[model samples]
Target: MPLNIDWRQILLHLFNFCILAIALYFLLYKPVKNFMAKRSARYEEEAAESAKLKAEAEELKKQYSDKLTNADAEIEAKRSEALHELHDYREKLVSEAEQEAGEIVEKAKKDASRERKKIIDGAGKEIADMVGAAAEKVVLGSTADAYDAFLNAAEKSIEKEENEIK
Candidate 1:
């Protein structure tokens, strides 16, 4: 051996290093690379699924928003319609009340007029009877003259009532 180094030992050590490198590549490197590739593929698939779900959620939100807007408009329209109906009902009630009051007033006037006529007729009859008695006392004769006076007085009362009516 030159300078205390052996060629056979050097060759053996190089062969051992090559074997260790090849074994480690087969055992550790191949498996780690396969795991990384499968993990990246799974993450990409998950991202695509998440995007699809987000789009669906956005669509649902838009639909809900539109429905809410339409509902608000519908509610406003219904409220206005109800107010109009209430106003119309109130007007109808007021007009009906006014009409009823007018009718009652007219009826009261008619009743009062009839009562006045009855009183006047009664007073006229009493006056005619008093005139008949006076004429009997004055004439001191047949009752036929008193009857004629009573008839005359009753005719005058009837004439007055007719003139007043005109």
Candidate 2:
């Protein structure tokens, strides 16, 4: 009954406080700590997956770069081969054209020689005919002595021309 002392009531309050602390530890603290731990583990897993994906992407980029470099080298080699082929073809064509031109020039010279021979033959035949006709006119209605002389001169001239032709 004193104003400053009550041992029984203090013991009762202490027992109630202990019971509340036990209930709170099981109901709130344990579950909250478990949730926080699970969240942290999930974050770590996600970070590892992101790093793995980044590494794979870098490997793919290197492969593509190597392929591009090889392709460029192949293209350059093909271009060089084409240029060489073109040069060889041009040389062959030029040689063929030169040979054809030489053949044409030779043929032209042969044709000109043949034409000259033909013209000379035609002129010789015409001259012979003119000489024969003139002789005939000179001997027309002549005396026997004059006709004999004309015939002898004509024979000698024709023999001389034949010897010269030979």
Candidate 3:
């Protein structure tokens, strides 16, 4: 046999290698590649769904935050309104109390004045009666003209005092 390569043998080996490569591609490589592609697609779809759910969660969180802020503002407003109402109520009560106190004082003053006038009139009548009795006894021995003169002076003095009081 010659050491030189045979063309026919070389051609046969090249043809057999082509057939084996084709067979491996169709039997193993194609199916593995297709499965890998399907797995990648599934992963990408899951990632997209996760992102969408995350965005939805963020929106919900923002909505709840806004609601909480609004509730706080409303509570503050209501508290302020209540405080204003309380202040007004306190002022009204104080005003009414002062007015009632003033009225009571005025009534007391009027009552006191009436009582004083009654006491003064009673004292004056008693004094006049006592003086008349004394004058009658003292003037019993006097002449009728002298007695009448004394009585007239006493009546004039009483009238003058009464006029001053009035």
Model 1 scores worst on lDDT over the 10 consecutive residues at 128-137
* Two-way lDDT contest, 1 vs 2, winner: 1
Residue 128 Cα positional deviation in candidate 2, in Å, after optimal superposition: 14
Error of 1 at 98 (Å): 1.9
RMSD of 2: 8.9
lDDT of 1 by residue, 2-52 (tens): 698988888999999889989988899989999999999999999999999
Candidate 3 yields a Cα-based lDDT of: 0.84
TM-score of each: 0.59, 0.58, 0.73
Alpha-carbon shift of residue 50 in model 2 (angstroms): 1.1
> How does model 1 score by TM-score?
0.59
Cα lDDT tens digits, model 3, 62-159, are 99999999999999999999999999999999999999999999999998788778757865775566567557756665556556665676676568
- Best by lDDT, which number? 1
lDDT of 2 by residue, 4-61 (tens): 7689889998999999999999999999999999999999999999999999999999
lDDT score for candidate 2 against the true structure: 0.81
